[model samples]
Target: MSKIYQLVLHALGIASFSYSFSILHSLSKGESFFFSIHVISFLKNWFMVIAVPLEGLISILYWGILIYDEKLLFDKPRLPILIDLGFHLIPAICLWTDFLFFTKEFRKSHSHIFYLLLFAFSYAVWIQFYFIKFGTWPYPLLSKLESQQRVGFYFACFALCTGIYHMGAFVHTIFNKSLPVPTKQKDKAL
Candidate 1:
């Protein structure tokens, strides 16, 4: 049951990423992709509201395991969990930096990055799946690049995201961490 749940979670992550990527790619190329069926439309709607946020939450959990060496999720030296952590953390950082520093509205709302990262992360997963099943990468750069280079790219992305996460975490820690506690009397009066 645990294994099945893990597989479903991973599949959900992949599907959310793929759908976002397809939408972004189509938009970038000035094309339209439509969903005619209700199920497809429902999934797409939920991708933005639910799946993307879940991805960010998973990324934070990954970072907690990797950076803080938390043991709650898995035993130590679990290579697959480590690898999966790497996968989510890299793009999570990328999207955060792109939003916080590069874009206007996104700086105020970091959650926007969740959706953006989903697009890139999904593409990476799809490329990996292609490599695994057909033994060839769909993208020319990924296909032709040396194994070391590809590994480096993945790590580099992780490092970049770690930096951004720290920065964002710092900002939130300092500026946004505290909130006013409501009084019980005031609450009751309201």
Candidate 2:
């Protein structure tokens, strides 16, 4: 189970949880002196660009596989209901909520596509290396796939993640547009 942290899903979940906690703590104190503004901004952008779409992908793929063929992901022992939801569902909801409602930094741009592609490719290499070193895949799905099939799977997932990112950006645009902007009230001049 120690190797579980190397799984992309677990890694992204950890990132999502950490980001949520960091944002909450920063908001509570009204200042983040620990990190410089540039570092904070970079981290925020990285999280929004890479982590958000990846989490969405993880959520969708995980639930889809779990529903379609549970045996593919697990053999006998199953995660508890809450633990499963915590791992597979809540990170997505939290990240998407933060992306849609609280964040305005995401915009439709080519750089986002680059970021997604970069992350997808990097993860593919990392997982391949892990498989080479460990004699077992992180997921049974990969173990069943041949080399070419795994490449295709990774490409398909990258495309899916790109689509998800664009969809989130589109929703963000429409949501922000529909929201009424706040206006300050003027005192009565008597």
Candidate 3:
């Protein structure tokens, strides 16, 4: 997919989610429907919620496919292979295609790294909250690991997100050399 297409998809996805939440907020309060900036800002963390998916995809591929025992995956609830692919593998493929193909227009600047980190940190907080509330780890890999190990896993996730952002920016700069940067210019002298 082209970078512009990916960016449009991401932006549309965010707007759609924000709209859905805003409608829910207004409806819950018996107010007329409107997209509110105050509400969106209040719920800003909900935007660009891609890092969690990235985390899941990365952790599963690294732990489940790369290092874990085969039987662990084969055994148990016996989820169909297609289901796993749908949830995990397919998104990774899409993310890669979005980053790798026709992406000269999508150069992530250094400031963008913070966006990835924000999501990663927010996700870690959410996971910690969920674990505390449920007394269960959401994933088998985390559940099996010790507390120290789990912290290491979270650290690795942060590192992975950071590396991805940096690498994306570097690739953008390198691959997009021939592409002209769009800039806003003043009107001609009147």
Model 3 bad stretches (over 4 Å): 1-67, 70-75, 173-175, 179-190
Give lDDT: candidate 2, residue 32: 51
The count of backbone overlaps in candidate 2 is: 0
Could you give the candidate ranking by TM-score, starting with the highest? 2, 3, 1
Q: Between the candidate structures 2 and 3, which one is better when assessed by lDDT?
A: 2
Candidate 1 lDDT, tens digit per residue, 83-133?
564556654554443323332211224553554455446646765776787
The lowest-lDDT stretch of 10 consecutive residues in candidate 2 is 24-33
> Top model by TM-score, which number?
2
Q: Supply candidate 2's per-residue lDDT for 87.
A: 77
Model 2 lDDT per residue over 1-190, tens place: 5455347456566556647644853554434566665566557766777877888898899899989998777755668889788777787888888778776655678988998899899989988898889988778888899999999999999999999998988899987776678999999999
TM-score of candidate 3 relative to the true fold: 0.55
Question: Alpha-carbon error at 188 in model 1, in Å?
Answer: 59
Candidate 1 vs 2: which has more TM-score: 2
- How well does each candidate superpose onto the true structure, as a TM-score? 0.33, 0.82, 0.55
Model 2 alpha-carbon drift over 4 Å, by segment: 2-9, 17-32, 36-39, 178-190
